[model samples]
Target: MCACKAASVTIVDGLKAAETKEKCPLCREARVYEGALHMEELNILLSRRCPEYWGERLQHERIERIRQAKEHWDSVCRAFMGV
Candidate 1:
């Protein structure tokens, strides 16, 4: 995983707490990311074997979604790609 780039970290923490603005767009078109500290974890861990996560900035609902996605992805990739 690539160490987080503090300047690009997203830690603002929206209602859904999306890692990227595309995951959860706020205010219609004005997509604001989280603060650096909060996003540091994501930015750092993203390059790791782990697919990706919302980090601490995510809400319970979003956490579940991320978990489900990861679990599904892991199952599919492991079953097919053998990773």
Candidate 2:
């Protein structure tokens, strides 16, 4: 339910103690192992088996495309204005 559901957690101890158990953001399943690319740093793992991960990836891709489009338009406008 968190806004950073897709982001990896790097172990930050807030006012409350850190969570002892780790689970998938969408499926709520236990993450029993570390990600191969984590290198013992990140605590959360996003597995391909989770459908939500793929969904989030697609959403992220869409957002990135939108950002690129906005940047392209901004550049074109700037060039037109000769600024």
Candidate 3:
């Protein structure tokens, strides 16, 4: 079995402990969350052997951007019509 022998690092932002983020054990990659809480750490490590990890992440980011843009446009229209 494959495993990352390196220790996990935690990054704290200013005095906000809640904003702390953890880097991946393998490549030191980090995301918005503190750790790989969205998925199993074992699965995340295994996914490094495939390309589906980045593909899924990119698709998620694209969908998030579209959702945010839609919300922004809706708010703008609401303000423009004075309603």
Clash totals in order: 6, 0, 0
Leading candidate by lDDT? 3
Model 3 / residue 57 / CA error / Å: 0.3
Candidate 2 similarity to native, TM-score: 0.39
Which scores higher on TM-score, 2 or 3? 3
Per residue, candidate 1 scores C-alpha lDDT tens digits across 6-32 of 223222223234444432222333343
CA lDDT, every prediction?
A: 0.44, 0.48, 0.48
lDDT of 3 by residue, 1-83 (tens): 01111222212111123334544455766543344344356456756766687677657656755766687789999999999
TM-score of each: 0.28, 0.39, 0.41
Off by over 4 Å in 2: 1-50
- Candidate 3: C-alpha lDDT: 0.48
Query: On a 0 to 1 TM-score scale, where does candidate 3 land against the true structure?
Result: 0.41
Instruction: Using TM-score, rank the candidates from best to worst.
Output: 3, 2, 1
Among the numbered candidates, top TM-score falls to 3
Assess the local accuracy of residue 49 in candidate 3 as a C-alpha lDDT between 0 and 100. 69
